[model samples]
Target: MDFSFPKNERIKSKKLMEAIFTEGKNLNNFPLKLIYLPSDFDDDTQFKVAVVAPKRNFKKAVDRNRIKRLMREAYRLNKGVIFNNSERDFALVFLYLGKEMPDFQLMESKMTGLLEKFLKKIANEEAV
Candidate 1:
C-alpha cells in the first residue's frame, strides 16, 4: 500500500477543523494529543489529518515547525495502524503538548501508541 501523505489526505478545511476541535473526542499520550471525529464518507480509504504545534508552548517558529515536521513524519510512517483496521473515515488533528523538544524516536514510539489507543477506543465505541 502507498504510505505517502498526500495533499488530499491533509485536512485543509477551516470549517472542518473548527468543528473537529469543538466537537471531536480527544486522546492524549504525552508529547502528542489527538482530536478525532469519525464521519461517513463515500470513500473510506482516506483519512484527513493535521499536525499542530502550539506557539504558546514552543515560543520559536523554528521549534514549532520542527515539532510539526516530526509529528507528520511519524504519522506518515505509522498511519497503517489506523488505515488498515478501520472501516470508517476519520478526521484527525495531532497536537504537540510537551514543554520541551522531543527526539525522533520518542515521537515515533508515542505516535504508534497513540494510534493503537485510538483504534481500541473506536472499537469499544462501535461495540457498545
Candidate 2:
C-alpha cells in the first residue's frame, strides 16, 4: 500500500465540515488546532485532512488562500509520518488560530511541529 494521503479522502463536503465544527474532537498545538471527526468514507488509508483559515482575521481572500496553501503543503509533506501507521482512512480538519498574516516560514515550522504532535497523539491513542 502506498502510505500516503491522497486527495480523494480529503474532507470537502459542506455538511461534513459543518458537522466537524459542531461535533468534532479538538486537538490543539500552538498556532494550529485540529478538529477531527470520524469520516464517513469507508476506506483503509489512515487519514485525510482539510485546512481552514479564518476570514475574519484575514480580510482578503488572497491572504486566506495563501495561508491555506502553505498549510496544506506542509501537511502533505509531513503527514507520511502518520499515514504509515494504518491502512484505514481518517478524517482531519486543520484550523489556523493565529490572528495575523503569518509568513510561509513561520507557517511551515508551526505546521511541522503541529503535525509531529498530531502523529504522536495518534500513536498514543492506538497504543491504548
**lDDT, candidate 1, at 22:** 89
* Candidate 2 residue runs with Cα over 4 Å from true position: 1-6, 43-45
Error of 2 at 127 (Å): 2.7
TM-score of each: 0.95, 0.81
In order, the Cα lDDT scores of the candidates are 0.91, 0.76
User: In order, what is each prediction's RMSD in angstroms?
Assistant: 1.3, 2.6
Off by over 4 Å in 1: 41-45
lDDT tens per residue, model 1, 1-128: 67798888888789889999889999999979999998654544468999999999888999999999999999999998899888888999999999999999999999999999999999999999
Going through the candidates in order, what is the number of backbone clashes in each? 0, 5
Indicate which candidate wins on lDDT.
Answer: 1
Per TM-score, the best of the predicted structures is 1
